[model samples]
Target: MNGTLTTALAAGLGTGLALIVAIGAQNAFVLRQGILREHVAAVVAICALSDVVLIGLGIAGVGGVVRLWPAALTVVAILGSAFLLTYAALAARRALNPSAMPMSENATTRGRRAVAATCLALTWLNPHVYLDTVLMLGSVGNGFGDLRWWFAAGAALGSLLWFTALGYGARLLSGLFTRRRSWRILDGLIAVIMATLGIGMLTNALR
Candidate 1:
């Protein structure tokens, strides 16, 4: 068990570090929530947990499943596009009504859950994630064919550590969200980002 921990940690940390440092949809959403201090802990947990699940699946050979069902990628692309567009519309609404933020706790919870679920969907549902994390990361981890598991373990741990720190650390800026204008601006930006990403994915799928 101890040895397996080391292997998992190494592989997880190595793979995790590579992707964790990169700027992507999940990180962007997490950072935004952190700044707003809305469900910071939940947001972080979701993001990290999502990564863990993906990485684990990758290591467990789900990458092969993804490879077999290429069309599933298209399905994910479509769903992700719709979700992003919807969220964007909501964000635009928030921009219009700044008070809607604090007064909307249940809404926030729903939004957070939606966002987290989206993050998971976006991360796992995409074939690219499997290609990178599972195929590539797994292959790399097994480099020496001996210490490869160690690499994967490290990668996973890196993701856990990075997401936790990022989500929590971003909350330090919660003070700025106090202003209605700030909320408007932030929400508006989120809307734009989500819409843009969604549209981009849709376009890619169409291509």
Candidate 2:
């Protein structure tokens, strides 16, 4: 039993890390907030907690229900694609306006409320979050049968670790991002990522 539990935990951790490590809009937002050093803790908390809830639901068999109604994902895909495209446009605009890329204390400061809102939106509005955490992770966890809860716990730990590291570890890149050019590059990459993801979802939905 002990060996089986350990295997399940390791499997969950690996799966969680593999899915979360991708460069999605949520991650891009988190990275930007981390670089700006604005409301990092709040952003991290919202993202990590949101994952916990979603993963819990998934392991509880919400994944099977979601799979039964493919139309629900279609709706999510459409809405998520629209949101990503809008965010991509904003990121592109920011990239073009170097004046907006300053890392100075005065320039980077943003309201905690606004930051939290964006963080939540980025996490919750993305359809991939549902597909990954709720459906994929949940389905995988169920494979553990009676030990599925252990798998969920391990996945949740992975999320907590990843977000904590991403939110705090980004400060280490502060020196590099001090330049407007660096910010431009980062924002440009974000724009590309968002656009690509949005288009991909749109395509998938239409299929």
Candidate 3:
């Protein structure tokens, strides 16, 4: 690639990673799935592919359309908040119920379809994803002028790499999570994170 394109790609990579690395509902779900060794591949695939699609749309200037439609985001925010709150309640219940913590992969481990559904909801329903991938990243990519696509490519690659690493690397913590107390702590933290994000979205939508 040319110097300008290369610079754009580098900028895209940094921006993508910086935005995604933060702790959020999606990341929390991915980490829990990784710990349980349940449908990790599918979850990772959904997340990575979702990012690719969103980033592509952003590069195509769909961000402008999003900016024009405030009600669309408000709807998404409401739905996302409901989903996040529901998941948070589940997580909190799990944290309180020791019996819910599975020592081994069992039927209670989420099935592929269920996991896929949750993954899609967590990714698509979250308005923050739109803001980050579609608005922020899209705006940044547009700054690259003719090299915007190159920037999108870099951002997509960043998503692929980060999700792959997070999904797979979480296995290294498998040993640590084998204990019941660990599961409690994990679910508790997830509950807090999810609830906070959900409430924050609800508050933003109300305002």
Candidate 4:
């Protein structure tokens, strides 16, 4: 009801929307699985649910903990870079292999569980996700003083909307990527994106 609250909400919404645009491993996995029509609902559910949990933690003062332990964040940053680099290398290899097939069927429950586990790892293991969703967003919301809750609400809502749209809509373009060359291009792009993000994180950590 106050100006501070309004500002915080606006800031949170803006930050969430902006960050969601970046295609990370979680988003890529969700989109890829969605396009293949394999466990589409499950993938979207996991992505959205994970965002909700992380965003809620951010609003609950988790950022304060992250800020207090700079060394821990530095370690996370290095580890995240390593993970991203490793993933990028794997993606590059996949691109080089032209025999790859799109995921075509809903996995068994156990297989779905495995995929969920992988998604959880991708969502939580990367320091960038924590830094962006928890520390950065939470810190900014705290700056709203009396209106911090509104900002948190906006951010959470933004994340929910983004994951829903992205995870489902990617299927619309499934036809385009059914070709072998298209898979190669998509994998190549993913590899480049991951490597670039990893290098950027390493640079920031060093500085």
Candidate 5:
């Protein structure tokens, strides 16, 4: 309500969005789900909720604990890489197989449970989420002193808005994806993004 609060909130909003708008495995997955019109709500909710929790923890200084335990992140990095690579392979196969596109007659809708699990893994398993939301946002929020809660709220709101728009707004573009080549291009992009992130994680974790 105060000037400080407003400033912190705005700062948090801009910062939060900037971090999430980057090209990454999570965004790619969400975009894919959105375009397919399959499990969009579930994917959006999972990603948004995960960001809120992480933002809260960061504001609460839990990033310190994470920093003290390097092995924890290493484990996550490894697991995340494996999951990403697996998803990449699937995506690549889809890109190469015309009948495998989600819009195809033979395409299958993944179960909600599977979609939820994949969303969770994409969100939580990535070490960059920890670094950006937990460490970066947490550090910045805490610097706000007593207004850190407002900052967190702003960040949380940003997450909710971003994922919601990305998930649902993707539908507007769904019409464009009806063509087989469109789906192929999308799947191919997803494959490259996921594989690059996976290999990067694996390389970082090993070193």
Candidate 6:
């Protein structure tokens, strides 16, 4: 690629990776699944592909149509908050009930369908995601003039690589997660993250 396109690609990759490679409910879930070694591929695929689709829509300016309807974001905000808070409660319960969990392979796991649905919910329900991928990324892409598609491709690739690394690389932590106390700590952290995000969303929507 030419220097300009390469610049756009690098910018997109850096921006996208910066946004996604941090603490979030989705990352928490993926990390947990990775530690469990259950449905890791499916979870990673869902996150990566969903990001690509959302990024594509944003680059195409579907976000403009979304802006014309404030009610839509408001509705999504409310729903997302509720979903996150509910998930937080569940995670708290798991934290408190650590005795019920074991890291053994034969231990019960969430069914593939259930995990997929939750993965979708966690991905699609968050308003912050729309702001990040749609509005923010779109604005950045537009700043590139004619090379925006190259930028979009880089952003999408960054997301895919990050999720793949996070989901699969979590196996390295299997040793730590093998302990029940570690599981409790993880669940507690997830609870806190989810609750914070949920309350933040709810308050913003109410305003």
Q: What is the lDDT of residue 207 in candidate 1?
A: 86
- Ten-residue segment with the worst summed lDDT in candidate 1? 102-111
Worst 10 residues of 2 by lDDT: 99-108
Error of 6 at 136 (Å): 0.6
State each model's CA lDDT, in order: 0.70, 0.89, 0.92, 0.76, 0.94, 0.90
Question: Against the correct fold, how does model 2 do in TM-score?
Answer: 0.94
- What TM-score, over all chains together, does every model reach? 0.78, 0.94, 0.97, 0.81, 0.98, 0.96
Single out the weakest 10-residue window by summed lDDT for candidate 5.
28-37
What is candidate 3's lDDT per residue for 40-115, written digit by digit as tens?
9999999999999999999999999889998999999999999999999999988998888867344276679999
- Candidate 6 runs further than 4 Å off: 104-107
RMSD (Cα, Å) for all candidates, in order, is 3.8, 1.7, 1.3, 3.4, 0.7, 1.5
Which structure is stronger by TM-score: 1 or 5?
5
The numbered model that scores best in TM-score is: 5
| Candidate 1 residue-wise lDDT at 190 | 80
Give candidate 4's error at residue 17 in angstroms: 0.8
Native-to-model Cα distance after best TM-score fit, residue 125 in candidate 5, in Å:
0.6
Using lDDT as the measure, name the better of candidate 2 and candidate 4. Answer: 2
Candidate 5 Cα deviation (angstroms), residue 59: 0.6
User: Considering only N, C-alpha and C atoms within 3 Å, which residue pairs clash in candidate 3?
Assistant: none
Name the regions of candidate 3 deviating beyond 4 angstroms: 104-107
Model 6 quality (TM-score): 0.96
Model 5 regions lying over 4 Å from their true place = none
Q: Please identify model 4 stretches exceeding 4 Å from their true place.
A: 1-11, 103-110, 203-207
User: Residue 196: error of model 3 in Å?
Assistant: 0.4
Q: Please provide, for model 2 over 33-108, each residue's C-alpha lDDT reduced to its tens digit, 9 standing for 90 to 100.
A: 8888888999999999999999999999898788788898888888888988998998898899876665634455
